[model samples]
Target: MASTLVSIAGYHVTEEIYNSSRTLVYRGYRETDHKPVVIKLLKNPYPSFSELLSFRNQYTIAKNLNLPLIIQTYSLEPYQNGYALVMEDFGGI
Candidate 1:
């Protein structure tokens, strides 16, 4: 099921937390720093232009937030033919 994304070079996905038609969310960590991270990736490796735009919009909104309780977004990365939204993982989702 396109699980090729589980072990990318900079991140290691420990477990998948959610799956939907549009996205895949995983609990993972940054390889170099061993920092826990949440990865939200587009389900399709090659999504349509509109889908890509929506995904980017999600990242933009998340990264701009300054709320203390909301986990912070670290980066929006190109991965596995799609994009992965990396965020701070507070252990529970």
Candidate 2:
């Protein structure tokens, strides 16, 4: 989608891992820390308001979680017309 043409500050999108009408997940790295991270962004061409809210709520809950079993959320930022969720990368094991 249009997100492919955009870039997220402090992160380099190495490859796209998943894409759907609601979200896009990318294999990326944090520039400042040089750590691998997974970047999840809301797909462009805006989704419904309810969907957007759901996405935000999910991220909010993820950010607050402290369970060892769950991947920790790094940060969230405003993307093109949506939001981006950054989490620890867990690929290529």
Question: Candidate 2, which ten residues in sequence have the lowest lDDT sum?
Answer: 1-10
Name the regions of candidate 1 deviating beyond 4 angstroms.
Answer: 1-5
TM-score of 1: 0.88
Clashing pairs in 2: none
The C-alpha stretches of model 2 lying farther than 4 A from their native spots are 1-6
- Angstrom error of the Cα, residue 50, model 1: value is 0.8
Positional deviation of residue 55's Cα in model 1 after best superposition, in angstroms:
0.8
lDDT of 2 by residue, 1-93 (tens): 555534888788888888777677889799998999988887765767887788789889998999998998988787866788888887742
Q: Please list the C-alpha lDDT of all candidates, in the order they appear.
A: 0.87, 0.81
Best by lDDT: 1
Question: For each candidate, what TM-score against the reference?
Answer: 0.88, 0.83
**What is the overall TM-score of model 2 with all chains considered together?**
0.83
Candidate 1, poorest ten consecutive residues by summed lDDT: 1-10
